[model samples]
Target: MTRSELVTALAQRFPQLQTNDTGLSVNVILERMAEALTHGDRIEKRGFGSFKINFRLPRTGRNPKTGQCVQVPAKAVPHFKPGKELRDRVG
Candidate 1:
């Protein structure tokens, strides 16, 4: 689901919280996660999953369209590994 859907669901689940408050809560949670990722920190939520950064080395890749060699720059990407609880639930 999208961000707005999550906000709506959170607001519904916690009737004591206002929509604006719920929105802020959701935004804060997302912002914190982003900040952690930006610092190369890993996040692990019990029964959910773990998020970490993976580094890809620069490499030469072939262009499928023109069959020409291309240089691909190195980059750090986010990776997610599901927890056992989540995997079990899905399975």
Candidate 2:
């Protein structure tokens, strides 16, 4: 679900939590996750998945539109690996 939907669901499930509080909670969690990823840290949630940064070396790529060769710069991208429990549940 979208972030807003998650907030609404949390608020509904916990009557004590206001929508605003739930929204803030979700924002804090997401911000922390992003911060960790930015620092190249790994985050693992049991029964869910793990998040890490993967490095891509610079390489050449073809431009599909013009069939021209282009240089691709290296970059660090976020990657996720589902845990066994999550894989089984989803499957």
* Candidate 1 local lDDT, 1-91, one digit each (tens): 9999999999999999999999999999999999999999999999999999999999999999999999999999999999999999999
Q: What would the per-residue lDDT of candidate 2 be over residues 8-34, giving only the tens digit for each residue?
A: 999999999889999999999999999
Taking all chains together, each candidate's TM-score versus the true structure is 0.97, 0.97
lDDT of each: 0.97, 0.98
Error of 2 at 74 (Å): 0.2
Ten-residue segment with the worst summed lDDT in candidate 1? Answer: 18-27
User: Residue 22 error for model 2, in Å?
Assistant: 0.4
- Where does candidate 2 clash, by residue pair? none
Candidate no. 2 TM-score: 0.97
Residue pairs in candidate 1 whose N, alpha carbon or C atoms collide under 3 angstroms: none
The prediction achieving the highest lDDT against the true structure is 2
For all predictions, the C-alpha RMSD in Å is 0.6, 0.6
